[model samples]
Target: MKVRIGVGHVPVGAHDPAAGLAELADELEAHRVDSVWLSDLASAPHTVDPLIGLAYIAGRTRRLKLGTGVLILPGRDPAVVAMQLAGLAALAPGRVLPTFGIRPAQPADRPAYAVPPGRHAEVFEEALTVVRALLSRPNVTHHGEFFHLDEVSIAPLPAKPLDLWLSGRLPAALDRVGRLADGWLGSNITSGEAEACRVRIERAAADAGREIEPDHYGTYLTVVLDDADERAVGALLDGIRRRRPDGADPRTLVCRGWAAAREEMRRFVDAGLTKFVVRPAAPVTSRRDFLDQFVAELGPMET
Candidate 1:
């Protein structure tokens, strides 16, 4: 398997992350890493807006693929997000990859501007169609259950069609990805489970008469340097446990050290999922320090 590795994170400390993202992008590019991804969490004051943050990094680097591990699609206007992505596509050319996901249901994590509780799926499905039409057509008119558009269109289309990837592991969500998405970007699932999901997605793709690249299947794996601060591990798990409640051993979910992380990567590759984005599983005093060491350690392992 030809594995590709990338790194992403929720910016925890940097007050202004534009310079920081740019610097990190530069480092990733220097190490010949496949991409640099950003996690989108608009409500988190500590996190930067993924789209805006990526634009800054795009301007600074020429090679690293700037991606959203998963951009929330339920809360915002699809036309607006499509326009922003379309503009970035022009500026950055063929190096943009977007992965779509739903917003958090928890009250505190929900964006100040977001779809109502329990109605996100409805809005997201409609808006995703709107985005697809707008990105592919010079004139798009959509009148769906949750959105309305009349002969509207976005300018400066991407040099190539934008392939929207989806992130999820539930049966319904996996089927949706196979039917509507170009690829998958799952997380927190075991290799055996990932293989099962891949089978389901393949069946869905075949039924839909669409074929995706073998390499587009990917996942986000939480990783922390073995020697990272103990207090940091506790803080990180607190945040992660809130999102992952399946009772899988946290150690199984996280790569505790460089050797362990690489071994886990190989297993995922054997499972037919090679594209990966590793995010720190613990808090750290220096984002740069963590990334600097990570990229260097991971460089020798990439195929």
Candidate 2:
């Protein structure tokens, strides 16, 4: 399988969205990165909408593929998303890949965007099916538990079908990827965990009477880099600490030094992951530096 390398969104905690994205696009184009992705955080302050941000970047850069890391599917109506995506693809032909995922909505965000506690995955599947059909056909009518469309068609169709990816951490989600998604994207998972997840997805595909070829499996890793000693690295580590999972230490999850980080990526690649999206742990000042170091270490492998 071919290995693909991509740069993901810088955590929106401390950066100015417009300036940060502008700089990021320039850096990615300079390094010849494969694809550029942005995150969708429903309630985060200063976070740009992923689709709008990608459209802005699309106009600025020529060759880089644009994608959403994972758009929280349950947050918006599928028909609305389909229209938005179709329009974006019309503007940037064959360049946008829409990645969708099911996320547990926060308590504070529930009133604004509500899905029953256990029903997000089901809703996501139904929504994706509706959207995919509408994008492909001229006039489509569908009735599903979550969505209903009658003779709907998306105009200015894309040159090719969009590459759809699913992201999650549950076995059920892996099964959904096998049956519905064109690729899988994971977060904060170890290499061993990734391999196990891939196995489950392949098994689910087989069980569903689908053939599994070279699946596009991608993982996100937190990386910290400093030209000096660990103190500079520690600052970046602190940023990650703020976002650590409920019971885990941030230090345990980050790849610190350049050498160690490269080895960590190697392990994931060896485990059958064909793509990687690296999330830098540093602030804006250090983000470019870490990106440069990462490209120097990993770019040749992709080439």
Candidate 3:
């Protein structure tokens, strides 16, 4: 299987988002990196609107694929997102990969969507259907519990298909991915866990008379390169708290250093996962320095 790596766009502090992304898009291509990704966080200060940032990156560079770790797909108009993605696809056809996620029942974030927390599942499914339909054709007429459209359409169909991927480790989410999404983009789970879940997904796909591409399984790994694991863990705890399953600490999920991170990728490769999006937890103090370290150390390792 072929291996591909994508760098995640995560700002640390006091940085120009555009400059940072432009530099990253260039460096990623220079390093032979396969793709670049952005994290969508409306509440977090370190994140940016991935749709906008990724589009900017797409315009700045050629041959570098763009992606999102997980774009929240709830509590918004599916038509707006459909139009935006269609526009982005027009700019960068096969190069764009947008993964959708139905966010959890967070009180602060839930209110903005207006849909009850309990109904997120149904709404997410319907919205995804609408977005898929809108992206594939010039016009779509859809009627669902969350969205209603009358022959609405977007211009400039993508040169190639914009395959939608789903990210989540929960059982219901896994089943949803198998039944609906074109691929699975997961996080917060180990390689062994991913392997076991792949079986479940395959069964669900069979039940649904659908199939997921063999090499589409991937995970979003947050890597912390620091002097000590404790320091790294402390810095990342607040951000990944929700992702830390059971009683697992931040250290259990995040890579401790360069060697550990490479080894983890090898483990994932052994588990039959070939795609990865590695996000750095530390600040991008120097783009050149960060790219040098990331490319030299964390670039795809031979298995």
Candidate 4:
């Protein structure tokens, strides 16, 4: 398998976010990191809007692939989303990687991504359909329960069609990836779980009479430096616990050092994951220290 590694959005604590993001983008480009992913959190004050942040990064760097780790799709207008992606594709060409999710990450923020009651899944599917149509077709007429588009067209379409990737670990979500998406970028799951999910996706695609590309399975891996400060480690523990309250030990899920991270990456690669987004478990005091380590260690592992 061809392994491609990328950086996830690292929190810019106590720094000017605009400047921090610019510097981070520049450094990633300088170091030749494969890509940079922005998380989508609609209500979080600290989080940057993925599309806008990506556009900014696109301007700052020439070779970096820009991604929305998982943009929420049910609440947004698909046509508008398509237009934004088309613009980005026009600007960045083959570097726009969009992975969409059915809902926001947090329950409290779910209301902010408002869709019809009990119809979030349906709305997401419909919205994706509309977005795909608008991106690839010159004139699209889609009539669904949630969306109605008549002879709509988005100009400046991508030179090549954008590959629509999806996120989620549930069985239904895995099946949907086979039926609709061109790739999968899952999160917060073990290598064993990811392997199983990949199997389901392949089975679904076969049943759908469609074939997904072999090298499109990817996942996020959060890691911490072994010598990281106590506060940083504590924050990382708390964040993972809150995000996953299902009693899984944080140590089992998070890599404690560079060696551990490499071993985990190897396991994931053996399990059929060819793409990775490695995020810091917590905010670091020195971007250079973290990035330098990233380059010295995981960077060489890229195929």
Candidate 5:
């Protein structure tokens, strides 16, 4: 099996978007990571807009693909997102991948987004269809259940139509990915869960008489340097516990001690994952430090 490695950013409690992203982008390019992924969170502090951040990084880097780990689709109009992604792709050319996701319900006070309950699969499928049509056609009009487009055309068409990805955990979402998306993007899921999801997606595509190649499967994992002091490890574990008290054992989830982490990577490789987006644990003061350690550990495993 082949495996690719990438890097992800978590804008948790960030205080300075410009400084943080500048540092992170430099580290990612320096490490030669395949992609740099940003998350979309309504509550994140010091969070730079994902597309703007990617554009900034694009000007600074030469090769790293700029991507969104999951851009919640329901929160924004599909046409608006299509235009933004298409513009970004035109500016970056072969360096942008827009990964769209269906968000769960939000409070009434929150922005008005229309993803009906239990209908994320249907909504996402329809939304993708509309977005793709608008991007690929000069004068596109559509009247869908959730969205309506009237003779719209985005100018300076992307060097190529943006590669779309879907993010979700349910079987319905997996099936939708098989039918509509260029790839599947997710996080905090174990290899076992991912493998099962992959099976569903492949089967769904086969049933549709679509011989689509397996959509790219990508997951974000927290990385911790092994040679670091016990205090460092403790801080990392504590952060994980704070974020997910009910999730897997924090220690097990953290890829600590380079040798042990490499072993874990091997397991994921065996499970057919194409890419690993490594994000450092909390209290990670030095982005380069963690990335350097990851490169040292991952170098031997590279195909």
Candidate 6:
């Protein structure tokens, strides 16, 4: 398997978004980091809208692949999303990597990602269908429970179709990925769990007569450096505790230092997961420092 590493949204606060993003793009490209990802957070203060941020980053850098660690897909208009992604893909060519999820990560933000009551999965699947149709064909027509379209198409499509990835851990979600998603991007799960999840997705894909690329599987790893302050460490633990499954230790899901993070990636590679988007568990004092340490530790690990 080809192991590739990408950066999740940098947690360090930037006084100037444009300059900061430009610097980030330059550094990541210089380091030859595989990609850069932005998480979706409609209500979070100072968080860049994933799509808009990616568009700006696309203009600032040539080699760094742009990704939405995951943008919430169910609520947005599929046609618009299709066009937006199409635009990004057209601009960046092979560098646009879009992964979507059905719901926002934070509970307080869920309401903003509105879907018809009791039909989230259905809506998500249909919305993806509409998006795929619009991205590839002209004068497309789609009529579904949550969306309706007629003779709608996005022009100047990507030279190659963009691979649509998805994130989810539940059985139903894995099934959905196998049936519909081009790949999977999991988070907050152990290597054992990730291995099992990959098997499940592949099985479901086989049952559905589909096959996800082996190297397309990836996950977001939250790492807390040894030098992280108490508040940062405590906040990471507390958030994970609240989100952890019953009886599961929150500590088991996080990497404690660069060494541990590297070891964890090796474990994941052994489990057949090849792509990674590693995010600092808490905000860093310096994005450049964190990235420098990140490359020193994990750069050689990529194959």
Per-model TM values vs. the true structure: 0.91, 0.88, 0.91, 0.95, 0.85, 0.96
Off by over 4 Å in 4: 14-16, 242-246
Candidate 5: misplaced stretches above 4 Å? 10-16, 104-119, 226-252
Assess the local accuracy of residue 30 in candidate 3 as a C-alpha lDDT between 0 and 100: 78
Q: Rate the local accuracy (lDDT) of all candidates.
A: 0.79, 0.76, 0.78, 0.88, 0.72, 0.87
**Model 4 per-residue lDDT tens digits across residues 46-98:** 66789999998999989999988989999998999999999998888899999
lDDT of 2 at 121: 70
Per-residue lDDT of model 6, residues 117-197, tens digit only: 888888899999998888888779988888898788788977888899999989999998999989999988999999999
For every model shown, the clashing-pair count is: 0, 0, 0, 0, 1, 0
- Candidate 2 matches the true fold with a TM-score of 0.88
Model 2 pairs in collision = none
Worst 10 residues of 2 by lDDT: 104-113
Regions of model 1 farther than 4 Å from truth:
10-19, 105-107, 111-113, 285-292
In the order shown, the candidates' Cα RMSDs to the true structure are 2.3, 3.2, 2.4, 1.5, 3.6, 1.6
Which lDDT value does model 2 have at 228? 41
Per-residue lDDT, model 3, residue 180, is 93
